[model samples]
Target: MFITIEGIEGCGKSTLMEKLANSLRSAGRTVIMAREPGGTSLGDRLRAIFLDSTLRIEPWAEAMLVNTSRAQLLKEVIRPALERREDIVCDRFTDSTIAYQGYGRGLALGPLEQLCDLATAGLRPDLTLFLDISVAFSRARVVGRANRQDRMDSQSDAYHERVREGYRSIAQGNPQRVKTLDGSLGASELLQAALVEISVATQ
Candidate 1:
């Protein structure tokens, strides 16, 4: 199972990813949990640079760097595990580029999708859970965090709103593969909602 979780920052993807992994492990499934702009040593370096709030990056540059990290991750971690028949749960993937760079930064979608296809070699999630939240709650959750905001996190409300809208559009376009969850709901509810789709996907 190649499952990817995506959403705007502060949308509780990390929390729910943890729960999903644990549940799968409890059921004796070998789950490989991975995150991106990360998941390998090279990816970590890119992640640090990509997430640095103090730095400014051009839209194309941002797309290139993150996809570079993702490419490294696919080679180093994601593919091998899948070949071994291990279930993989990934945090963010190609759709993020479309949402963030293409939608949020107003980059050209056609090229961005091409970059994504090149980076992932056409491998896509078997199931995608998009935790949906409004920009206002997204802002509140992000602001309340104790850690300093990342470059993407520090983007303006309008940018985040556009990203959220992009996610909605992506979900609508790919309904068979992606399911949108209401992030304002409690964690357990979100987990149950996700598991419903997981059950169908796995069956």
Candidate 2:
């Protein structure tokens, strides 16, 4: 299964994906954990550039850069892992581009969707977990972060709100493949909920 987790920055995507990967491993599944704008040598470099808070990237440029990384990650990591019958859990996928660049950045969704399809070669996640949180919660969590904030994390509250809404819209549009989870839940609860959803989906 190619499982992707999506949400606004600081919505606990990393924590949830880690727990899911560990759970899958405990069940004797070969799991590959990946993050978008990453998961390969070239992707990591692009990730650094994308998150360099000092740099200014236009919306379309940001979209293309991420797709470039995605193309590399698919060729080097995700597609091969799937070929080996391993379960892959990714922190973000093509949907992030649609939400961030299309909705949040105010780009055309049609072009963004086409770009994603081209970049990924029609690949889509078998399951997508959308962690839903309010803009207020996101702002509080991002502001409380102890580490250096990435460019996405440093976006304005309104931008984060649009991204969050974008995620919700995506979930609504893909009811069978996308599951919405409350980001305010406890860690254990969230993990269990995700497990249940995975169980149902894969059954």
Candidate 3:
């Protein structure tokens, strides 16, 4: 199974992804946890450049960089793991490009979608968990983080709002594959809800 978690910065995706991976492992499944703009040597290098807050990357340049990472990740990590019958839990995936660049960066959505298709070679997640949160909550969470903020984290509230709405639109368009979860819920509650969604989808 391929599962991708999608949300804006500070929406608790990494936390939830960790719990989800552990839950699946406890259930006797061999799980491979991965993150976008990463998951391979080349991907990691690209990730550093892509996420560096100091770099002023153009919208198209950002799109190309992430897809380069995605393509490498799929070729080097994701596909081979699936071939071994292991479950893959990813922190972010193609939908992120659509939301971040297409919506937040004011790029054309149609081409972005096509670019994602080309990058992934038409591969789509079996299930997606969208953690829904307010723009204010997202900002608050990002502000409270102890680690260095990335490029996406440094974007304006208006940009994040557009990205959040883009996620909503993506969920609405792909309801069967995208499950919306309340980001405001307690961690344990959110994990249970996500497990339930995965259970039903995999059945």
Candidate 4:
């Protein structure tokens, strides 16, 4: 099973992913946890270039860099895990490229999706968990937690709003595979809800 957790910045995706992986491990499932844009060494270098707020790159360039990192990560880590039939939990996936570049930057989704599909070699998560949270709340959380913001996190409010809406659109289009969760809830509650969703999806 390949599960991905996605949302806007500071939407508790990492926290929830950790909790879910821990629970699955306790239940005797061998889980492999990874994150996009930096899952492998080559991906990490690409991530640095992509996320450096001071570096100004073209939107299309940014999108392609992410795809490059994704391609390396998928080839080195994700595909191998899936081949071993390991249960994988990822922090973000291709949906992030669609939201961040396609919606946030007003780029072309058609090309972005096509690039991502090629990069990932048609790998898609069995289930995607969208942590639904307001843009304002997400920004506040991110600002309070991070001393310095990344390029995406440093974007304007409108960009973040578009990203949030992009996530919603993706969830709506794939209701059977994407589960939306309220990110405002407490950690334990969110974990419970996610576990329920995972159980149902796997069953």
Candidate 5:
């Protein structure tokens, strides 16, 4: 099973992924945990470039770079894990591209989806967990936890708001595959909800 956890920055995706992976491991399931933009060596280089606030890039250029990194990651990491029949948990995936580039950057989503489809050759997660949170709450979490912000994190509040909307749209459009979770809950509560969803989906 390929499961992706997605949301805006500081939405607790990473934390929840870790908890979920541990839970699955304790259940005797083979699990592979990974993250986008840096799952492979080449992808890591692209991740550095994409996340660095120092470099100014056009929206299209940024989109292209993210897709390129994804192409490499899918081939080198994601596909291989799935082939082994390992349960895969990913921090982010194509949804992030749609949210960050298509919505946040005001770019056309059709072309972006097309590019990603070609990159992954039609591969997609079996279940996508959308950790829903407001842009203000997400930003506050980031500010309180970290001293430094990435290029994407440093984006304007308006951009993050658009990204949050994008995530909502995706979840609404794919209700059967995307499960939207209210992330304002306590960590244990969130994990329990996610595990219940995963169990139902897999069954």
Candidate 6:
């Protein structure tokens, strides 16, 4: 199963993903942890360019680069592991393109979705956990971080607000497959919720 974690910046996708991966590993499931625009040799280079704040990338161009990385990662890492019956935990996937490029960057959703389908060869997550959080709170978490801001993280609060709304809309549109979670919850609660949801879905 391809399980993805999605959200606006600093919504705890990465941190929670680590714990999720650990939990899955403890259960003796073969797991592959994939970070999008990464998890492959070509993707590593693309990630550097994609996340460089100094680079000015048009929305369409940004989407293309991201999908390119995704295509490579899927080919090199995700697909191979899945063939081995490994459960893949992806940090981000197609939904990020829809939210960031479509809503936040003002691209047409229909065309972008089509483009995504082409990029991914129609691969979809079996279960998606969307970490829902307020734009203000999510932005503050990004600002408070010691790490340098990436291009996406450095986006305007207004832009992030649109992205956040886009994620909610996606979750609403696909409630059965995409579970919306309150990102503001404590770590224990979040983990418990995740475990329960995963259990129900995978069972």
Per-residue alpha-carbon lDDT of candidate 4 for residues 12-65, written as tens digits (9 for 90 to 100): 988999999999999998899988788889988988888898899898998888
- What's the CA error at residue 102 for candidate 4, in Å? 0.9
Per-candidate RMSD vs. true structure? 0.7, 0.8, 0.8, 1.0, 0.9, 0.9
- Alpha-carbon deviation at 104 in model 3, angstroms: 0.8
Which residues of candidate 2, in runs, are more than 4 Å off?
none
Task: Please estimate how well model 5 matches the true structure, expressed as its whole-model Cα lDDT.
Answer: 0.91
For 59-147, candidate 6 gives per-residue lDDT tens digits of 99999999999999888888898899999999999999999999899999999999999988999999999989998888789989999
lDDT of 5 by residue, 1-203 (tens): 99999999898998999999999999999999989888889888999999898999899898888788889988888888889999999999999989889999989999989988987898989999999999889878999975678888899999999999999999999999999999888899999999999989989
TM per candidate comes to 0.98, 0.98, 0.98, 0.97, 0.97, 0.97
Error of 1 at 17 (Å): 0.8
On lDDT, who's better, 3 or 6? Answer: 3
Residue-wise C-alpha lDDT for candidate 1, range 100-175, written one tens digit per residue: 9999999999999999999999999999999999989988999999998888887899999999999999999999
The global C-alpha lDDT for each of the candidates, from Candidate 1 onward, is 0.93, 0.92, 0.94, 0.90, 0.91, 0.91
Q: Write the per-residue lDDT of candidate 3 for residues 1-203, one digit (tens) a residue.
A: 99999999888999999999999999999999999888889999999999999899999999999999999999988999999999999999999999999988999988998999999999999999999999899988988999988988888889999999999999999999999999988899999999999999979
lDDT of 1: 0.93
TM-score of 2: 0.98
How high is the lDDT of residue 13 in model 3? 94
Off by over 4 Å in 4: none
Q: Which parts of model 6 are misplaced by more than 4 Å?
A: none
lDDT of model 6 at residue 169? 90
